[model samples]
Target chain A: MSLRIPSVLVSLVALGALAATPLAAEPKSRFKVGWSIYVGWMPWGYAADTGIVDRWAEKYGIAIEVTQFNDYIESINQYTAGAYDAVTLTNMDGLSIPAAGGVDTTAVIVGDFSAGNDAVILKDSTSLAEIAGRNVNLVEFSVSHYLLARALDSVGLSERDVRVINTADPDMAAAFQTRDVTAMVTWNPIVSEIAAMPGANLVFDSSDIPGEIIDLMVANTAVLADNPDFGKALAGIWYETAALMVADTPEGAAARAAMGAASGTDQAGYEAQLAATRLFADPAEAVAFTLSPDLGTTMDHIRTFLFDKGLLGAGAPSADVIGIELPGGAVMGDPANVKFRFDATYMQLAADGAL
Target chain B: MRLINRHPGRAARLFLGSLPFLILVVAYLVASAARLADNPGDKLLPALSSFAQAIETMALTPDRRTGAYLLWSDTWASLTRLWAGLGIATAITLVMGLAIGVLPVMRALLAPVVAFASMVPPLALLPILFIALGLGETSKIALIVIGVTPFLIRDLSLAAAALPREMIVKAETLSASTWLIALRVVLPQVMPRLLDSLRLQLGPAFLFLIAAEAISADSGLGYRIFLVRRYLSMDIIFPYVAWITLLAVAMDLGLGGLRRLMFPWWGLEGRR
Candidate 1:
């Protein structure tokens, strides 16, 4: 004789199983942030190493873990996948990948923009128009690609006018040395290395589109909403360390030295990269920049470029698919589907001495 | 091991054979649970649900940007390059290996050169290939062929050289031409070993394919892995790696099965 298990018993067991697993709750005390090696983000490493991060976290009654990823993309990926609470990313990448992938992210601190750091260099040609009909080697679908598109737009040309050869960033310098590769778009120190070569001309750079290519410390909007103090602590650490690094005092020099060592570059090399990067050294400046209308226009340009390149996801109907909320309730793209948000509240708190 | 091999029933034997795989699964689950207990947000050793979700997104959902299922597209791209590279390498190996092994002049001229070429790391020639061949499908395919062909040629040549002397002498005594002797005697003996050599080269072939695709390619399994890798989407990465392993294993099994079916007399002794 077989004992029969009733359907009611099965339902009860299923419900019990479902109830056994607890739902994810807010992380109250501990948080982790991931950063990559870049001149602008070096302050994070310095802050963590110098105990500034610990001090700020202690004030907030929390523990913050700062992890450095060797690969720039991996850090952003880790943050997007929820391994880290916050990550350093570019405006275009933040929009294209995470926001487009349906992760609600907020750019809390506008760390810096590529002023002259990203550039288009031509072999033996001093003009942007000379790039027409030439094979340009660059890391395709990267900021260098965006820079190329913008440079081409300035000359009243499009991607159709030139051939793009997708060369890796590491191989860009060497690829440009080849007689066949006439032009290249890359970032420092590759850009600097190539520009210094004989017959290499810097025809265009990110300075041409100031504030368009932004580097940011973005946090998951849900995480930021749940732990507002995390943002405050991060902002505090950023501004304090940034101000110290920018100053001419020995303390500032030491900070820069530490940052340089952390990023595998010398003091002069770090300084060179810094010279090309426009850091928002002051909290008020960062706050104001986030609040400005130019931020909207820059994001609009980025979204359009991303959509056109098919980097904004496969079925993105238009550039407006990923809504970006700026400071003061202004929104760009799809207002209903707002994923990327610029919350200057934390930066404002820092500026107003609230942190 | 002896106990499992001596098992009388097929079911019992199969169950015992799968014990190691079961052990691995249980071990992974234990480690994953421990990690999740400490930090729920850990990306390393992600939960099984996350892996399932990632697989669904990559394999089922059409990419919102390209309107293509990433997994299928990447598989097609990678498989196309792999087969093309392997096909070309096989043809070259068959001709070059046989000629070198058979003729004294060919062996003297080609053996040392092929041996030396195999010693140079294939990755070092990537830049030269890209520069000379351009960053097209040609360069990627060329890289795979270049990477695996030398090793395959050397193996095949050695296999061909090891052929019994009496067979060749008998064929010559029968007034068989050089071409007839090679086609009838050497070719039949070497073909099965060639399949074995091809199987051996699949791992290196995949390595070359991924390296080439990683450096430059619009789409491929390697390209997709590296692309989503920027986001540390382990869910997609783990499945992709698993899929690649599955594909490689399937290929190995298929080749082995074909060898058994086609060359019934060719046993373990026949394989070098």
Candidate 2:
């Protein structure tokens, strides 16, 4: 109901913008990066609050605007619509949403992957096999759903065996309290909250199928190509904040506490979440992971999954419709129509202490 | 001449009524075409061809996994929940509204509670509904009932209470008891008003139903919109919204027909 006011205001602003466009047209030096609440991506918010983002931007003679979103998917959608120059999302989402939607996106940083943070929790179910016939509840088409698909595949069962109930994240916890909802697949801190329920069994998690659900900071390829300094500024801001988040110093402790508070938790709660995530706190490790051969295999799996779910753009006959240019000039999908790329230059620069 | 006296002919009135809609459609098309020309993949405003393809895909083609044409199944699911919720609310309101208005004791007890409950935002209890009633159709229906029942009761009760006191006195003089006066005098006046209250409450009921479904549901028009929204599929979302509007308009028309058939004398400007 409140949206109507903003919609009317937006139209007025749009009309005003039309009149002001001529005077405002200039070379773009400022970039906006959209991020949502996540353990791996929390550093973006912390850095922005502490002026690390602006400091790096000043160093590179550019201005970077880091904004936080309450919704994960909304940030990605806005980024895909050209409202933001960059966004933080999982590799699967990057491929399925922006890449499939014809936005040329490139990963500037590989943050972390879920180890045990995401899970499939079943009430009174002891093993993954018990989940065969039950309807799996999750945020449909999200990483949780992808995890469920992978979980079912491990046991030789396909999506045909069980129905997928598309439940929202806010309702998943309460829905699980009802006896009718016996099984759910979700991510932490939701996963951690659900696991504490009586008779709840954590049958499978991202830890079991590691490195597939990668967290990344992806930017528009055309925008990055025009302004290399924007990429450098982002890499600089990230490494500095990443170092502080995991350090044993008091300042690091304070950084973690602020991030936890910003993410709707406390210090200990944030630490518990960090324990389940495989955070690449080191720049070199992040670069190594981005260039690894396993990334190719993971991308192959992701593209195939997206194609099967019909998320790889409309009328896409195969997974090859959206090309993904990997590191070292190797391309997956159609080489002629590359839209998603895994670029490692900025991260490599960060690793070599050259950023 | 006064502005109220300057009325158009029926043909002119129809054209005037339709002018705004035509202008909106033309504006949307022009904006969409311009966006598409700049970047064909703009999902914010989908092209006309994209809309046609989306409509065909959702309304005509059967889903791959479920083998159900999404449009019909969603409509069936949503309509069933709406009917069940509104029907149960209307029945409860008729009985309670009459009791509260005709009987002093019932009014003293329920009027305060009804006012309080009506003020409580219905969406706030959505999670509790899921927790208490489970995630099935029951919780979704319960949300709608909890959302609109109080208002329906209030409307009917006021209509019942407004009956001239002399009628009740005369009925009592003829040996009509409390129950007799409620049945003979109050129910007759309030029954038609119940229909009006139900008609007014349809829009709000649909809002509650869609919110519940969007949060959690296996199938519904709201569920489909939120589900495909993960991929930013505006192509599908726009059409599903239009279909829901059309369905709501048809329902309004149906209720208006029922009102005319059942009680042709009852109307907004007092009974004929």
Worst 10 residues of 2 chain A by lDDT: A16-25
Off by over 4 Å in 1: A1-27, B1-84, B99-120, B124-139, B168-184, B218-221, B224-272
Question: Residue A168's C-alpha lDDT in candidate 1?
Answer: 66
Clashing pairs in 1: A77-B231, A313-B64, A313-B65, A314-B63, A314-B64, A314-B65, A314-B66, A315-B64, A315-B65
lDDT of 2: 0.86
lDDT of 2 by residue, A123-157 (tens): 99788988988988999889998899899999999
Worst 10 residues of 1 chain A by lDDT: A1-10
Candidate 1 C-alpha error for residue B153, in Å: 2.8
Per-residue C-alpha lDDT of model 1 across residues A223-342, encoded as one tens digit per residue: 888889999999999998999999999999888888888877778888999999999998888888888888888888899998887666544688988789988878887888888999
Strongest candidate by lDDT: 2
- DockQ category of candidate 2: medium
Q: Candidate 1 on B1-272: residue-level lDDT in tens?
A: 68756645798889989999999677667655655564454444567998987788789999765689989999999999999999999999989999998888999999999999999888899889887876778888998899999998998888888999998999999999999988888988888888887888888888888878777666888877665554345566678878988999999888877777777678664444
The CA lDDT of each predicted structure is 0.82, 0.86
